[model samples]
Target: MAMIEDAGRRRALRTLTAGALAAGGGLLSVRAFAGGLATVNMQLGWVPGGNQVGEVVAKRLGYYEKEGIDFHIQPGGPNIDGVAIVASGRFQTGEISSSPSIMLAVSEGLPIKCIAVGLQQHPYTFFSLKKAPIRSPQDMIGKRIGIQSTGMVLLRALLAKHKIPENQVKIVPIGADMMPLVAGQVDAVTGWQTNTTALKPLGADRVDLRLWDTGVRLYALPYYATTSMLKEHPETVQGFLRATARGWMYANQNRDQAIDMLVKDYPNLNRADERVAIDSLMHYAFDQTTQTQGWGAMDAAVWEEQIAMYGQLGQFRAAQPKVDDVMTLDVLKATHSSRLKV
Candidate 1:
């Protein structure tokens, strides 16, 4: 919750000096001063990192306006399930974790489809006490580990990959707080740097071993949408993606400026320790995931393997749907925000 220093402001001013206006500056004008606006409510996940950057950037740069999609950014809660919110029509646009969601929803007859994947690489890390003598994923065997929820995507993925049965290990739901690990209530915790950043104030110094580093080759955060949504208004969705794409590009291009804006706007955000959360996102950039597949593409093999894993874990009763059919590249390619090919 440290205040954004004046030096950060100077950095932002210097950064903006390079580009007076954003790439799609013209799209923001007109259709305002005014009434009759189409309302779009977007939901946020528990933490703000790579997943939240697109919406934050798009909102700041008016890329939503460029696409003619009026959006209102709504903060998500701790216990609120993102997929349930989206399925219930509580929000028009939002991001959610991939595993145990898309496939399960499709079988249950939900009209949701993954639009874009935000995290090319995941940020979830398994942390243990420095003196616990734990070094790697194998060390976690027969140990009680902490995670946010029982069905949390990362924890389940880790368990399945290690060939460790839940019966052998106790899974405790930490719910976005990792201080219990420091207090010895839990041996290791499942969380991102965002949660850990908040823990700095509590004097909990822990190391994170990025759990995805161990054999789990999968996509983490993917944007979802309903078929009915796309069919009713293709243009609006396309514009939203275009703006989202530009916002991501802008945010990546200008990190210091964006971080300054984020810390300044959300004063409760722990600024002193934000470097970990901020710098960890460097791995997710324009080229690796987005440019390779036009912002929201997933490999069929990866998707199928994930669903099959969910089935194996008994996370779902029946086989999941063909994810290749659920996710579409038509809209992203049509928008062509940049010259990237997928």
Candidate 2:
């Protein structure tokens, strides 16, 4: 009976040993199964805007290396379209503006998902001079405003919601220096808070009406990934997010240096103006909505409602995307910051 019991124990031990070997071999196979290349690549929308800073720093500072990521940055423009590049399986991941990415992805049947939002709110902000006596968006009725493009849909939504007739305002194309408003070419400019930073030196103060008030309550742009990538290589996406969370934190606290680094990569453009853009970008990057949740927290209701507004303006042809349809909140799991809300 004793001998029989010992044999049974040996058989169980052998089985355990075989299982351990199989598990160890399976792990090695998974590691070897990683997508080839020592680096993971991503495309970015702009060349040197505040939007691309975290990715830029992650590359320059070797944080991506620590995360085992290889970045292939394909810098385009505020105007250059990368939706196809991101959606067609050419690149594993990239960033388009969050709102537009969501809207476009839903409209065109793309498989992209917004995994992380870098800022708390939209970065597009309006600025009037400190001495202009204009306190809010409602105060600007019938005033001439300089604008970057008339194609902007959110401005239209604000106008529609505020009951301001489209014809009541005069619109003009402007530059980063607030040249139109400065030269009395217009009442105020709808340029970014960063582009108008130079206005302070030119005898004007600025207000981040988005933060200071409740006019354009849009969400911040986000980093993105494909559905296939999320399913196939979740670890890569998670690593990228971990590196990116640190990158945004770095960009937010290290403003001037981030700008300086940006200028190093993007020279000959206006540096001072770019700094304001960067600072404002960071300001909008971290906001109350984002603060309450994780760094990339988003409400599907807010996004769908905004998309519906765009659809009303003829920007889209489809029904508003379901909140879960366009955006997902899973990547925030990559952050170890217990302070992260959502």
RMSD of model 1 against the true structure: 11.9
> How well is each residue in 220-288 modelled by candidate 2, as lDDT tens digits?
556777777777778878777777666666777787877777667767556777766776676666777
TM-scores for every candidate against the unseen true structure: 0.75, 0.75
115-212, model 1: which lDDT tens digit per residue? Answer: 76666665666777666735676677777787765336556667668876757777777766767787787778766544446556335446567755
Model 2 clash pairs are 39-70, 40-70, 119-285, 120-285, 121-220, 194-276, 194-277, 293-341, 293-342, 294-342
Candidate 2 global CA lDDT score: 0.61
Instruction: List the candidate 2 regions with Cα displacement exceeding 4 Å.
Output: 1-38, 130-132, 173-177, 196-202, 205-208, 253-279, 287-294, 334-342
Candidate lDDT (C-alpha), each: 0.60, 0.61
Q: List the residue pairs that clash in candidate 1.
A: 1-270
Q: Using alpha carbons, what is the TM-score of model 2?
A: 0.75
Report how far residue 123 has shifted in candidate 2, in Å.
2.8
Score residue 126 of candidate 2 by CA lDDT. Answer: 67
